[model samples]
Target chain A: MARKALIENDALIDRLSATFREVGYEGASLALLSEATGLKKASLYHRFPGGKEQMGLEVLQEAGRWLGNHVLKPLAGEGTPRERIAAMTSELDSFYQGGRQACLLNLLSSPIGEESPFKATIRQMFEAFVEALASVIAEAGCTPAVARDRAEHGVALIQGSLVLARGLGTTKPFRKTLDVLADELLADLEARA
Target chain B: MARKALIENDALIDRLSATFREVGYEGASLALLSEATGLKKASLYHRFPGGKEQMGLEVLQEAGRWLGNHVLKPLAGEGTPRERIAAMTSELDSFYQGGRQACLLNLLSSPIGEESPFKATIRQMFEAFVEALASVIAEAGCTPAVARDRAEHGVALIQGSLVLARGLGTTKPFRKTLDVLADELLADLEARA
Candidate 1:
């Protein structure tokens, strides 16, 4: 019985993440979450008694961890700068396309006209992303300050590309923008070389 | 009487554009818009018989024109490349801060879950932005391809900065990012020099 409950908890988290990615926090109501998870409202309440806020926080933290391990870590690994950047860009494209989702940070941060408990968590996630990327760029031969700037630029590119992709209603531009940004960053490194 | 009606129509467009900038298209309902404009729903409907979609399209078009004239035109004007870039960056910061809003293109493009007329208009607005920025970069002594790339980068910076600002709940970083981007773009041009 305990094992079954764990499995159900995992399922609920996955479903809640997907729904939040699609509709944002305020937009995702208990009714919608219940329908998406194939669980009744009462059952969802049983798992997340704090309700949608609790679910949203869990989903965001999970996403942050996953993105850190999958996207940022690999890029910060030991590799030639060019290879590392290519890997990072490829990973981003795959994650976005495979998930068929926009950036969770952007969705969560949008001015939905209310204060969300998730905002601070989302901001911290981005700060971590910038720090991780900065470390990688510094390894690639940029000065610490330059690496920080490059990392900020890269984050801006990805975040903006997601907005563009969402606006264009297609992922092609998003993928293309990432590719372009990767090339630009690598070229800047080469010039320093 | 006709002149008075024309003035009222213009005011409605301005109010609607302001409202859209504050809240995204999906979140900005007719009720909110009516409240923002201090006009009843009946007056709003009288002005925009086709309802939110029609009003949204007009707001988008008006905002697009404002961006082109106020933001893009000055940057593309005759000045030293460094001067022109600085001017453009300052203009963008002021425009965004003055409105206390995110880019309308981004707001319109974000999903309310799929196919909608606003999508096409947003795409058109982006293309216009790209073209205008490209022209300026081209004028600043870059190859056409490089100019296009720079233009796209500029758009990405602006859009991403807004997201960052919203996430952090402050406009300072947004303004700072644009300043950094302008400096980067100028540095690239100087390297070529």
Candidate 2:
């Protein structure tokens, strides 16, 4: 029974995340969340008695944690900077392609505007991702400042690529952009060497 | 009377464009559009009988054309490549800040999942912007392939910065990102010179 409840909870979060991606925070109403999650309003309320804001916070946190562990943690592990950067970018491309979805950060960040309760969470998530990448860059023996700047550029490129890919309605540009960025960063590192 | 009608039409388009930026294409309903423009539903229908889709298409087209002329066109004009590039970046920053809004291209692109009707228009606008930039790059004496690649990067950066800014709920980062990109390009051009 405990196992079944965990499975149900995972399913609920997944559905909620999808709804948030499809509709902005302000736009995702309780009725729509209920419909998307296949739960009755009572069940949804039971799960998130704190209501939509609670549910949104949970979804954002889950996405941030998942992405950091699966998509980013690998990049921070064993390899030369070039290999790690390549691996990281390839993972990002696959993640986007596999899901046929834009990044959750890109989607959620917009609705969280100035002073929204979710603002700090979203900012922290972004900073965490950047810091993760910077750690990997630093491991490659670059100065801390160079590593941080490169990491910032890499994060920006990934986030930006999604917007461009979505705008062009093709994933080709997105993948290509990431590849170019990876190559450029690797070249810069090699130059330092 | 004709001049007044034209003014009203322009004002309505401006309002619709603002709504689309804030809420996105799918989120902007006719009721919201009417409310945004302070137009009665009857007046909206009179101006846009084809309804929301027609208004969206017109707004998208007009924005594309206006951006091309005011932003990209200047980049393709006579000047040293570095000067032209800086001018272009400044123009883009000003244009975005002028409206205090994210680019319509970035907003509309988000909802264009497979085979969207707006796909062609969006692609065309992007291609035009890149092509204009490419011409300038090539004039700076780079190979056609190199120019095209750099131009693609430039467009990707601009579009991506807009998304980042919108997601972060601050224009400062967006504008800063663009400035960083412009500086990078300028540095590259000077090295080549």
Candidate 3:
């Protein structure tokens, strides 16, 4: 799977992200990483001097930042809360390839994900995701507790659908879940209005 | 990690299950499988002629049947739908260890899981799970379509909560998702009654 094209740093991170998202932390051996990114083992070691541990941390950080910029920030942006939610869903949809893919966070958090030294980083990614969703709901005028609960619930559904959709061999479950999520997101704001 | 105790066939499967649940398909090398199952690589090959592929298919089937008997059969068993859903939830909670553990299907279906020959087996597992839940819901008096939708939604929430709960390092979200699922499962029946 190695490409002959010149690979930039960001491209390397993206390649690493794709590999990690598919095979997970422990499964992403140097051989697979080399194949995925078209980098030699020495090249990877040079790029990530700390080796797999550093590579994992960097990839997790990169995915987290991508979500923050592409998904969360838009939800917490200044448009109407409903509009913001819509934008956020689109961001998530694109990031996940409309449920055709697993979340990098979930992929990374597999058994190796749990055992990795980067566990805290994974936890932080989820907390930030939850917080971002909560902020939007709170702005929509629900009590803080209610808003937080909704955010947690929404995240859980989205995560579960990926498992189900993939398990069931259909994206319909995921697409339907998104529709339900859209409805759930605006329920409070519409109620208050 | 090979244990010295006499390992029953079921015990060996459980050990293999735990390893698969932890390291995933590609990550679970013969050496690791040997360590997990207390079998020499030659012994494992003798037991499973198809090697890792056979081992994976066997493990996935074992897990699927466990879910059918413990989770779905109870849900579709003789009882009120509420009672049935309750039974299913209890089985799921025990299986997941209150969100402290990840699902084997989820663990397996990482990139390698999809690429593995067991993909259809995984799909069948979900289809059966969905059907089992839908039967209980429909018997409670909803139309088949509505019951199916509710079952799908309920499964998605439960599945999503596992991801969220594991990611956030807490079981509260998973526990709460169960509550919501209970409500959703009976909502139509309760409304009609």
Off by over 4 Å in 3: A1-5, A110-114, A186-189, B1-5, B110-114
Clashing residue pairs in candidate 2 are none
Candidate 1 segments whose C-alpha is farther than 4 A from its true place: A2-11, A26-35, A40-43, A80-85, A98-100, A110-114, A180-193, B1-11, B75-77, B80-85, B98-100, B182-193
Q: What are the candidates' individual DockQ scores?
A: 0.40, 0.41, 0.56
Model 2 bad stretches (over 4 Å)? A1-7, A19-55, A98-100, A111-117, A138-146, A190-193, B1-7, B29-32, B98-100, B110-112, B186-193
How do the residues A17-72 of candidate 1 rate in per-residue lDDT, one tens digit apiece? 87877766666888999899888889888877888778888888888878888777
What is the alpha-carbon lDDT of model 2 when measured against the actual structure? 0.72
Q: Weakest 10 consecutive residues, lDDT, candidate 3 chain B?
A: B107-116
Residue lDDT tens for model 2, B2-83: 5355337677888899898877777788888878998877778888888887888999988887877876777867677777
Quote each prediction's TM-score.
0.82, 0.83, 0.90
Could you give candidate 2's per-residue lDDT for residues A1-193 as a string of tens digits?
A: 4334433777899889888776656667889988998887887887898998899899998987787877577776776777777777777777677335676676655542436667777777777776778887777668888776666666767776676667766676677787686666554566554
DockQ of 2: 0.41
Could you tell me which residue pairs clash in candidate 3? A156-B160, A160-B159, A160-B160
Sort by DockQ, best first: what order?
Answer: 3, 2, 1
lDDT of 2 at A178: 73
> Ranking by TM-score, best first?
3, 2, 1
Between candidates 1 and 3, name the one with more favorable lDDT: 3
